[model samples]
Target: MAGVIVDTRGLARSEQNGRGSAEPEAALPDSDRPELGGALEALSGEILKKRSLEISSTSFVTIISIILGVALALLAEKTFPFPRPLVAAQSACMLLLFVCTFYYFLSISIILRWAPSFADCAQPFIITSLEIPPTYFLGRVTGWDACLAILFVFVAAGVGSTVMWSPVSHFGGDRKAQRMLHRIFREVAVIFGTGALSLASIGLAAHFAQAGKMWWGFGSCAVVLATLGALVARMEIQLSRIHAYYGVNRPPFN
Candidate 1:
């Protein structure tokens, strides 16, 4: 559980008014006293640790984006044109990468800027807020994984294109190369789908388990999971359409 620092003076004033004739300091409950506040400061260290964990997750996204950007740039430098399906895949991947980067950057920014205020809430509120970080961390990891998966798909396409069009190569229109690329794509999709489902199930279970509590923390997890689910679903659809363009069926798990 996280620690919260309430304004003891204000709390005491209110409680005194309700009780009538009691001194403000006397009206203050032992839990709301300055000694308790000191104890809470220790608890707040745990909350700060969670915040740091999320910041580290943001760094993961940044590194992945840089690597993915370089790969895309190198691919762009090539003189050969990509097939329509590959071009579409590239565009979709870049767009989703941008969305994930922006999403994570914004979240971390809010946490850094408003965390002090959030720490001033009650004990239950502070504890409930901690529930969000686990699911949120998973969502960010999924984003990082997605960027890697996109890179893999793009690299495979580039290799397939080079194998088909290279001047010295006699393997032009190579069925084996094309099939290899397709197999890799489908396998990546299956792995991503499995991971996404596991993440969703865990998030949903957390949401329901906390729904009985009187806090908005559970709702926040639900929103995070739902938004993540939507993004992954859209990517899956785009991948499926690419498969269709190449005269292949959708991934078996889909």
Candidate 2:
């Protein structure tokens, strides 16, 4: 991101070069002189505001995760037993919620550590008019994007869990219907998985780029592409299996 440049040495340089001259001071253009103090104040306010919002969002997620975890635990303590598949689904949801909470906490920490600060706004510097992006862990890809991607996985898992629970399980016993539902569930899972993978890949590239390891970023990109191809093939194979079992025609993948 482009940002303000502060150059304090210009006046000193001019003074040295113009010693003994009639004009003791070099005149600076109005456009060249920016109100850095005011700019710094504005920037500081914005950073503080954003930091508060980030903390609040993470806190909300944490609280919700705790509530849901406790509720699940209580349900498990009931006398009636849950089917193994339903128990597994609920467990997966709980695990994913934990992951989402952890990811948000990590993102918040990174945001706080990198938030900009000015030691002295009055210090001589060249202030440019360019805008600077937030310097979070992922660089160009904001931390919120990655956080949302993780949450997306959690949501997808929660929705998939319905297939194993009551009401929905009524439809799950029919072989053809069950296969259809599974196909839809798998499609949704692949969609969310692909999105998360793409975001993570970009974040990894940004991380490597910031570390000055372009070679590593390139290698990771290749690996990501290979993984994506494999995901596509896996989906195709699943689709073919569903078609074979249901006596439906499989579409050509080319």
Candidate 3:
């Protein structure tokens, strides 16, 4: 009887071992599974490559701007035959350009990091500021020629606004359009206010110049102020758009 029981127990142990071996055979080795790990690694590498490319492109643009700015300053110094006092004015304008460019690059870096979507919104303001110093300096040194340049700039601004408006409206949806339209009205009011202020500054500068005020020299100072006001108005509009894009509806007055 003891032999029979022992044989029975041995039979049960053999069956359990056989089942365990069969279960392992049914399950494939982890190495032989789908290449999920390799695919994910490839995807990660692609994303890194794309990010690197974008960074490179942005750096290239900034470098090009810096080079162009230097060339512009050199050409202005060599070509324009102004009086010594006017040279100071020219140098001031160039300095402003350099400052504006540096600020722009800084702003780009900040916006890219903090608010990339708002970067486009801020671009026009930078461009408008860049145009100002040259316009003001040229107007002071060359009189009516500067006004012609300013007029051309205004026309360009109008054209650019028109070109950008439709696309932005379409992309932003109805709610965004409504917000933008409201902001546009506000911007128009700001523009008018800036224009009025500019006209006043022009009159004041003309008065001072005619009075033989050596300190006032020409209308350059007034032009700079007007240009700054114009840029500020443009920036306000851009910031408003950014706010609207982000679904921010804080009070405009705030």
Candidate 4:
């Protein structure tokens, strides 16, 4: 009768121990699981942040360039006495500069989307040569007729260029068709913007001349400077956005 004694308590204890072991396995932390996709997403976000900062910096530089250019022109005006012919020359120069700046901006925008390779060459040329010098001269030239004529020419160039170079079959497509369009739009904007700015400057200049208020002339110059700065700033911002969208690095920002 003592041969088959069942240890039911010991069997229950063993089963409980097995259950406890399985509970720990189920509760283990999943820290070691791969998150490659999450890491990539975070990396991409960092890149975008950097790019945005870079773009902002480039925009600042462009603003500065505009300021410097305008200042130079104003300084020249105050220091030198321009004759009627010189005034005419200055107006033409201003017109050219306005056209150039416009073309530069339009080109940069197009380059951002289509042809990046040409941007480097075109942008600097537009900024240094086209946008700055003409604006400077325009501010310096004092004749009303000169200013009006320049404005008229700018408007005419804008309209004519746009029509001539539009994506129509009348304008045959060559390799530089896109470039032409860019030039057309930029010139148009510049013509309008510069004309408005010049009118304001002229009014201020006249007020200063009538009142013998030298400061008024300076104020007019300042206005021109500010307008130029704003123009460049706007263009830079546009360029920055383009760079950001394309995920490219612009100079002074990279």
Model 2 accuracy (lDDT, Cα):
0.44
For residue 37, what is the lDDT in candidate 2? Answer: 57
What global local distance difference test value does model 1 have?
0.42
Query: Model 2 Cα RMSD, Å?
Result: 25.3
For model 1, residues 75-186, the per-residue Cα lDDT tens digits are 4443135434323343343344445434433332332222323322232232222222232122233332333333334433332333333232222566554444344334
- List the candidate numbers ranked by TM-score, top first: 3, 4, 2, 1
Could you tell me how far off, in angstroms, the CA of residue 190 lies in candidate 1 after the best superposition? 14
Following a full C-alpha superposition, what root-mean-square deviation does model 4 have from the true structure? 15.6
After superposition on all C-alphas, the RMSD of every candidate to the true structure, in Å, is 26.2, 25.3, 12.9, 15.6
Candidate 4 residue runs with Cα over 4 Å from true position? 1-141, 144-201, 204-209, 251-254
lDDT of 4 at 223: 45
Estimate TM-scores for all models. Answer: 0.22, 0.29, 0.40, 0.35
Residue range 1-254, candidate 2, lDDT tens digits: 36977677998888877764544234555666555455544457778878766765455445544554554454445312543432333333333434443443343233222222241111111111000011121112334234534544553564355344323343445556565545645665666566556656665665556664434333333433443345455545665555566677776353
- Of 1 and 4, which scores higher on TM-score? 4
How well does candidate 1 match the true structure in TM-score terms?
Answer: 0.22
Task: State the weakest 10-residue window (summed lDDT) of model 3.
Answer: 107-116
Comparing 2 with 3 on lDDT, the higher-scoring candidate is 3
Clashing pairs for model 4 are: 94-134, 102-186
Better of 2 and 4 by TM-score: 4
Looking at model 1, the pairs that clash are: none
